[model samples]
Target: MKLLLAGIVLILIIMWKPMPSGAGDMWRAYSDMREANWKNSDKYFHARGNSDAASRGAGGRWAAEVISNAREWVQERTGHGAEDSAADQKANEHGRNGGDPNDYRLLGLPEKY
Candidate 1:
């Protein structure tokens, strides 16, 4: 009778022991979720970095264009710019006609004639 009772207790202990299928599934699911979240975060940060670099390049190009336009506008308003452009054109034409390669007059320098 005592042996039978001990056998029943051992059987109950074996039945109540934790199983791998129960807690293991929960742990695996949690690990998969963590891995997926990490991958999503990495992709988001990579895309953000690419977008930031592209925007910085575009902004730099836009700033350069604005500065160029401003300088051209100021040169036009000063009055000397137009005259120099016209003189440069005329000097280029004269140099072409005379077949002169070294024409200092194209530089808008004062001529001593």
Candidate 2:
């Protein structure tokens, strides 16, 4: 009976959940969010050349949503308001000027008076 009780206690201790290490988990979460945000931002800027405002808006909105989500996730996970700094840098670096003429700027075709 004592042996059985000892085994049970050991099992219980093994199965118990360990407490979260705040900073370590938070850093991991921040890294994950940064990756996701970079992907979504790339997709949006890649498709931004479309003349359709609706499509552009949709892409923009999706990018914004993902970026915002990543920002909030990082902030909550890290307990700091980093606000998607990595993603912003990625957008500014690779996504902004890598595309065609129409993609670099927001100006559409000239209006027909």
Candidate 3:
């Protein structure tokens, strides 16, 4: 009975993913940010990544939350300013909650983004 319950729980977790591409989405956003190298655009990328992943469903939202929190926690200790980290977290939350990432995007950004 215990084994069966565990198996059922595992199955539920597996079934939660509409697709297993959330992490990749997050990574792509990071890569794009690096490529863009646009000043003051980091918050936009953070929101975009979380929003992109969250739109995929619960699994994606979970991945985005985990990755965003972990990244910010690391950054807080790695010489990044407190204000910047706080703003980043705010952007991340905004996206995860279905807020439009474009709200954070800067004008004049190229269409390829």
Candidate 4:
């Protein structure tokens, strides 16, 4: 009886769906890239002694472009592209709404009654 109970408990634990961590990790990586890009752009602009409003605007745009490129590269390398991010967001939202974290509906499937 104890062995059977233990088996059931283990199964239940295995079946439990935990919150996804990929989105958080992706966000952290993106933020890091953005910061690095911004710092590099700032240094480049400052080195050229071009701290005018136009220079600042150009630097910001360059930094954003670099971050976007880096994000796409990371996603392609990791096989977790924008679609995965969207699914993760949906699952996170569904979990916050009291739905199961692993629910199929979170993947945009029609819910079966």
TM-score of each: 0.24, 0.23, 0.86, 0.25
The sequence of per-residue lDDT tens digits that candidate 4 reaches over residues 50-84 is 11111233333233333334544686688876765
- Whole-model lDDT values for every prediction: 0.37, 0.38, 0.88, 0.37
Top of the candidates by TM-score: 3
RMSD of 1: 35.0
Residue pairs with clashing backbones, model 4: none
Q: Which scores higher on TM-score, 2 or 4?
A: 4
Residue by residue across 21-51, what tens digits does model 2's lDDT show?
Answer: 2222333334543544543333233223221
lDDT of 4: 0.37
Kindly indicate the candidate among 1 and 4 with the higher TM-score: 4
What value of lDDT does candidate 2 attain over all alpha carbons?
Answer: 0.38
By summed lDDT, which 10 consecutive residues of candidate 1 come out lowest? Answer: 43-52
- Predicted model with the maximum lDDT: 3
Candidate 2 lDDT score at position 105: 33
Q: How does model 3 fare in lDDT?
A: 0.88
lDDT of 1 by residue, 1-113 (tens): 99999998886555433332322332333344354454323222222222222233333223323333454467578774676545433433332233232333123222321
Superposed by TM-score, candidate 1 places the C-alpha of residue 99 at a distance from the truth, in angstroms, of 29
Query: Per-residue lDDT for 1-113 in model 3, tens only?
Result: 99999998986687467335777788999999999988898888899999988988878888898899999999999999889999999999999899998999999877777
